[model samples]
Target: MVTSEKNIQMIMELADAFGPSGFEDDVLTVARKWAEGLGTIEEDHMRNLYIHRKENTGNKPVIMLDAHSDEVGFMIHSIKPNGTLRFVTLGRFANIAMSSADVLVRNALGEYIPGVIAAKPVHFMSESERAKGGVPEISSMVIDIGATSAEEAVNRFHIRIGEPGVPATKCRYDAENDVMFGKGFDCRIGCAAVIETLRRLEGMDLPCDVIGVLSSQEEVGERGCKVSVKHANPSIAFVFEGCPADDTFTEPYAIQTALKKGPMLRFMDVSVICSPRYQRYVLDLASEKGIAAQASVREGGGNNGAIINTALDGTPVVVAGVPTRYIHSMNCITSGYDFEETVKLAVATVTSMTPEQIAKF
Candidate 1:
């Protein structure tokens, strides 16, 4: 009945949908269906879906809200004569995370066949090999679909090379604790934020016209965002991300992104240094509004902001990262409160902005 619960349902469905870079049809379907009454929807050849808000006035300055729809997934590269599948990644995948994972492969018939990522039995490993100390190599990995041979896999399972695959993890929400566990939060959570932000702004008169783009192929490189920026010529942009949480691995003094924190606004990631003026505005606004937020200077990772900020002769951009743990793996965890706060901060920041104030940034 509450705002977070309603959006969690959307996030669950988004996370469950099978989509990878260049193969985001199912994810786009979930977004388009959710956007039905909220806007005019349009998409490009690359499967980037755009939601043009109902209250948008073309006369106003444009505010582009961006999130990638594609999750880190894999494509079947070949079927061994013995029936297991060899795969190549569509995006960055944790090598250890892939071994023994429950996965669903898209078949030639457009059906998903449940399978398990194969791994050598512990008993079969030599002590010397065990000492090597790292995840199994991709060449040593395969997806077993319970088939006897390559012919059976293709003929009966209808699976073939180039088909996409994603983790088969189901979504779970603990309403009492306000926590979410699932897969694909790396960006599906971001996709949900874009939708929720746009939905909240519907029917309200604002300083800028807001357009939400559920971009594709972000994990493969910010490919879809490149096309989205060309379509959305905006004066400013909000890049929402489901960023990695550092609470578990980071030292106490170095912790930047952590679960239960409202949102992690990054000053720099590997690809882009955020606009200082806009970043400062959000930070100050969060303080004024009592919205909990953390600022981080990431030593690694990238997002669509890197590409969008440099477009249309430069646009001011700030990335709001929702702290998520174990992202890009089979299982991920995020705080529902963090998600809600992110939506709140974004709504307030955009609504409170003015053309003159933006120019100063």
Candidate 2:
């Protein structure tokens, strides 16, 4: 088992890496380095990394644990006639929070340039405009890189259309409350869980080969998972992810799930409906083991449910997620306790699967 301190360090490191949709190379590099001494690691054509452990006889069907390596970010659409830069959203983002926020712009050569979202001062707005409230539209936002003119901006930064911009910051811990806040925890936490679980299972001689996929392009769609599943051809799969929840202000009992309670066993979502039998099996295991868990019926589509359910003509799929608060923003928060417990649950589920159990499904 990975020590608590080691797990925390992994989470922080994964969260600190920069990986927006279609630009996951940096994060993938870090993951590859971490998997070097662990086991045999392979990267598919889609750039999804599959880390595995040697299989044992009498093992169940191949089980895959999928986690996305992408996060929400922006792409430079054009360099304006002036020195300002105009960009479009690469993923879902709130314009209100984006305006005037510090951002990191990556050029074609992978250079990090500091910039900020520039907006009209509130004092210059009319009272009626102020009454209407909210920041201006995304199209009105401009990226300021401290250049004087268009010529000077082009000369110094070489800013071009289609560059990627991400939030500029690092993950930090709230020592007083033990809360860790940073960007990309939405699914990087999931990636860290899969990596750590495989590390924990080292030399266990487990049945059936287990594939850990650090999937890409999940924010735009489950594009990477579709290709990875076709290649792995696993008969059963589990997707490790972080689910959005607001339990601190909302009543925990009334809410769908709460942080630090353990993994949330999702029953259904828009992308894919979980297999009833597999869902029951996971829940039963959690109950028998007295592992903290909850059920979630998310309103929107998410996780690897879309591809995993349809892989290999049909694969039984389950999604285990850590409850994350304030997802898709500059700072997403989750519980360290839930993260550790989710890893435990995934390792147990994979190890407990048997050939008979898979065939019965």
- Provide the global lDDT of candidate 2 against the true structure: 0.80
| Model 1 Cα lDDT, one tens digit per residue, 1-361 | 1245678899999989899889999999998887788889999999999899999888888888999999988999999999999999888887888888999999988999999999777777878767865357966899999999999999999998999999899999988888899999988888999999998898898878999998899999899999999998888999899999999998999999999988999999999999998999999999999888999999999999999988677899999999999998999999778888898889998899889988999
Error of 2 at 89 (Å): 1.7
Candidate 1 TM-score, true structure as reference: 0.98
Please give the distance, in angstroms, between residue 319's alpha carbon in candidate 1 and its true position after superposition. Answer: 0.3
Off by over 4 Å in 1: 1-3
TM-score of 2: 0.93
Best of the candidates, lDDT: 1
**Whole-model Cα lDDT of every candidate shown, in order:** 0.90, 0.80
- TM-scores, all candidates, are 0.98, 0.93
Among these predictions, the greatest TM-score belongs to 1
